[model samples]
Target: MLIFTSVTWLDLCLASAAVYLVKQLSGKKNPAPYPPGPPGWPLVGNIADIPHNKAWLTLAKWGKKYGDILHVKVPGRHIIVLNSVKAAMELLDKKSSIYSDRPVFAMGGELVGWKDGLAFLSYGDRFRYYRKNIHRVIGSRTAVNVYEPSEEIEVRRFLKRVFAQPEQLDAHIRHTAGAIILRISYGYEVKDNNDPFVDLVGRAMHQFSQANDPSAFMVNIMPWLANVPEWFPGAGFKSLAREWRQTLKETVDAPYKFAKDQIGAGIAPMSYISNLLKGRTLSAEEDHMVKWSALSLYAGGADTTVSTIYSIFLAMTLYPDVQKKAQAEIDAVVGTDRLPSFADRDSLPYIEALVKESLRWNVVAPTGIVHCVSEDDIYDGYYIPKGSMIMPNIWSMLNDPQTYANPSQFNPERFLDNDGRGPEREPRTISFGFGRRICPGMSTHRSIHLADASIWISAVMSLAVFDISKIVENGVEQTPEVDFSSGLVRRTLSHPEPFKCSIKPRSAKAIELIQQDVNY
Candidate 1:
């Protein structure tokens, strides 16, 4: 080692002083304090502390240590997680103009071409145009009414599949949800369970979810890695993205092209696409928006419904009394000769309670697609910088003991008041989401037509037709361990697991009604 003189030592001290001054100056713009959070390391911040599994629960735990509005930084990014319904609504709803934008999802949005989707689009003129057009087709409750015949036919098919192969309940649910969305979006019939469109679309979404996992790829944090050549060493993510991009292209293009061809040939069915095509001539840009917006409908619809219905199955297995109560209510209103329809929903109060409870108990999207702050602002006396990711901890809000007494228990009675007629509380307020960014399909408005979500309709139909009970092996009934997936969206993680349950037709009349399928 070389010896340093007083002159060299003085130079080093001056350099260190200059760096400190620069750091202080950089923080002056947003000198307001960040929301309370766990201690973080220098430079890396709380990167390692970011939970990889069930992050929504982890964030809630952090919220207790920090405050309701917890702040954490990951490298150059800022993340604000709202742990309570109050905070979520204040920021995501009351201040939606600034909080409705989405963060840049490099893997899911950019590389896979999902940025074109309305769900992932940035806040701008294009976003508004896409949203407006999507609403025109699927915005109203009356619009859903137009599809009730098809929905009923599909539900009947679902009932038949369940009756035949109850062991494949998950597959049947997925198929029904997929078929309904496919038919509604493009008038495409899902040919059996192995339709190529279903498979391809499933693969594309699987890849998107994989990429969506915060830890799945580093390129999400360091977007520059997306630019690396496919052949570059350790650049396999690029190839993965390309493969998924191709699948996504085919998923959006195949059905859309067919819909266009049918429309041109004058044999078009009354689908969302056909309805859109019949009206006014669309410019190239408008056409592009419609194509991708329709795809967003498919992306948003099926998986959440399938996950919740699976939760309902699990709930029925665990809570037999709840199942019995719902069945009793359904039987009293709908009778055994006919299956339940949308009209029967209001009449069966217990079934409605069960549906609401299913959503609140095991939320499909624990932390909904995170919103981004479009400008710097202060919330609860803490500074939230522009472009910060705002995560609404839906799980915490739904599970909070203060909100729902005995929150861990799966009790539908929480929603029923003394009369057991009108609801004391509404879970949909927390389940679908908050503010302007709320799920379009789940929102309610009396001014518009009575549009209902497919999930809600499917849940009522399933409960109406089948009697769910625990699976017995070797003379012992087994309770399924509630092992849900830790993905951004919750689902049963693994297949061929021990979550066995049996579903049977409640009566011969029910089976007969299901078999007598009506043509749409």
Candidate 2:
């Protein structure tokens, strides 16, 4: 009996040793190799160090410590942050073929129905189809021509609102920009802030931002947890996921139904939905495509553009000299006798500089959308494994001390030439994004920004006089220090943050031109 027991024990020991050998061999076969970063704890990884508010600011500091290509591990995931323009361009742009795919999130894609959205769609035929359709409506010269009338009307309306109630400048910026995109994309107008369509889109966008957050759901990191039945009372995340999915579906479908109703009644205007629906039948895939595309436009066009305009206002108030220079250029070129038009953009160099500077100073999407690697690749002799998530750290790139002297200072002169000509400034760092994932809205955004900035500078001479120094805290007045918060997008950190300034017409001619020329 003792001999038999010894033989059985030996067999068990041999089985355990073989298992260990296999695991070691497998690990060696698929070794994870990327740049160096602080070691992460088991399970949670480096999630605790990721700042919820100012993530980019923290990321920039980390970049300073660990070179440009830093590896970050998040339980079962690998994130590579490209901190410089050179690295971003090399990996994201030059090797875009394998870098265009976005990381898959079960909640955002499967539950929230983002699989069809152009921004989140995987690189494939469906994505190609969506891009082709988008380009047809908003990409090329023909689309720009088609959008001209609406753009003009909206800008005029924006100026009129600014002239009538300067206090509501923020709301005006939101409305004018939102309305034009709405009109052009869906043949709808934002009649008021309370508009259901506008409110629904806003709510949906907020939810999307939250859902996209890595920490928003544990199931995102450990998706197997989702398999637990929703009826189980203790399934905390399951319940929340259900609610988010429901809200997303409603938000996405509401505008879609409106578009469909309009199409069915033959009242369909020459908008994106109408154009696409003209010759196409709604297949299941196409339905997904349409809904997601609509959601993308509503969310992407509204939030980021509005945030940029807000930053512009904040910058103008904080940096009076920058505002003064922009106004001076507008006055000299277009004069106070006429409203600035797209054609005058070439001549108004200073206004152009101010726009570029505003974008740089307080970047809208600071960390930028994440990109995923499709295959294993090498960069500078470092192994970038397949399926590593890429973060183009825009904050680091934009604030590179070597590229922009006094990087923290809000100076438009950095982008301008000595002759006062706004030279085409190449990004010493990547801000928008890299490669094929570069913002398709670049041209559209440039035109809108230039037109809006020029008008604001010309009409509101007091923009230069606005003082952001006064802060009211606990019913007491004091001067507030300039501070900003970081996130996927950066926002002004300090509050009671109202700028105090008197806005007056730059000239009598300016008032007359604004009052007469503005069609709204």
Candidate 3:
């Protein structure tokens, strides 16, 4: 091959520039009709307008100004926000295949080494592989029941901790959730709050949430900045990413290695990891996937479960009437002689409604793992381009006045019909997400998962065992505030601010029942 002259190199550069200009210019010609949104400024588009905190609320307000489905453009990218159930169903659910992909989460995924996670994976055969494995392992009806005893054991342990040290309820919940997830995913037991595994995983998760926050990393917006040296000015995020990567790697590998060691020693408990490892001889890549997926299960389940459980407790404290009503229903069915179990779910209609309402009242995953479009599509005369981010405003949908009357008020009766048989319209608190990207592991100790009812059993049992009320201080009752955090996952924003709650035994029989259940 002959070396190119300066003139030749210049000509080549001109040709490339010409093609790029043409491509950019062509896109502007006959541009598809994008959905109505707040008018954005030149160059930056809506990037400046996007609210870092409480984005869902701002999007909902935008929905009222601009129709139910609205669009906002950041430089070189597009975002579609769906604020109504009808609109979300029409696109995210009805046309799922084309709208089920995930956006490129540069900061949260690649930089932090979370790309192996199923939640952040793009739509493809690999995504399908992870999804298939997850569903096979935990999403199936049979698989869910297989893990019920582990869930039940962890939950009873949590109840005992709450009964013993209710002041440390938060730590107890965090410990219980971590322990249950570790046991189910890797056959690993979390010994205490200071367990190395819990600490490592917890740090990774905390960093993950921070990295995912829109304002946390600038490299997410300008990806090229990631290539810059870590020591460069304004490149501190890269250093942070490096630290996160180390923690995350340990989070993904440590428990998996422990499980493998147990299996090799012939003392491994049956678990998602142990079973999968024993079933087949996977390639190196497949093995990596399994490890990451197992870690994801632990990471995904723990904090979300904590949030929902906290919300349940907050709701009970705030609305004693609802608590009394659910307790009455539980007592009527299960009797005060024993703690309510999954067997009583069929009879406790009010408790079921209470569960649904808690999910709907203050959703956990508000925007719910934003979906991306795989191809260009048009809905109601508006164009949604391929690769556009789709945010289903679950918070808005949950609080829709049309679907839920007095939605802000904590009311379980909304789930019941006039006859009070079952749910009139199931709460679309799809906090787990939607379409194929939906969270396969949705079960928690206080909420029902798609396939598992063990956690639901725990929630009812807690309700049956304790009467949560405002703490009586000197002669006055101080009610805990129903304040919530504004993050990707909604949580009781209290920063260990000792919320006053009098967690009293419903009766002597109830305490006896709790002891009996705890012993089992």
**Alpha-carbon deviation at 333 in model 3, angstroms:** 2.0
Residue 4 deviation, candidate 1, in Å?
Answer: 41
Candidate structures ordered by lDDT, highest first: 1, 3, 2
Report the lDDT of model 3 for residue 65.
93
Q: How accurate is candidate 1 locally (lDDT)?
A: 0.76
TM-score of 2: 0.83
Model 2: per-residue Cα lDDT over 53-139, one tens digit each: 767777788888988888887655788988888898889878989999988766666666555567788988877677666656666
Candidate 1 residue lDDT tens string, 1-520: 1121232434433554565567677856665889999887655568788666667777889998888998887755789989988899889889999999987668878888888887778988988876676666777766767777778788778888888898988889889888888888888878875798889888878877776655466667556667877776656777778888998999889889988998888888778789888756989987888788778888887677777777888888899899888878877887777778877766877776777788788777888888999999998789999999998888889888877888778898888875645554577887777776777654354222212346556667777778889888999988888866653232212212237898888777777876785566
- Candidate number with the higher TM-score (1 or 3): 1
For residues 200-227, what per-residue lDDT tens digits would candidate 3 score against the true structure? Answer: 8888877877776554555665566668
Select the stronger candidate by lDDT from 1 and 2: 1
The superposed Cα distance between candidate 1 and the true structure at residue 274, in angstroms, equals 1.4
Top candidate by lDDT: 1
Residue 137, model 1: lDDT of 71
Strongest candidate by TM-score: 1
Using TM-score as the measure, name the better of candidate 1 and candidate 2. 1
> What is candidate 1's CA lDDT for residue 455?
57
Local accuracy by lDDT, each model:
0.76, 0.65, 0.74
Can you give the TM-score per candidate against the true fold? 0.90, 0.83, 0.89
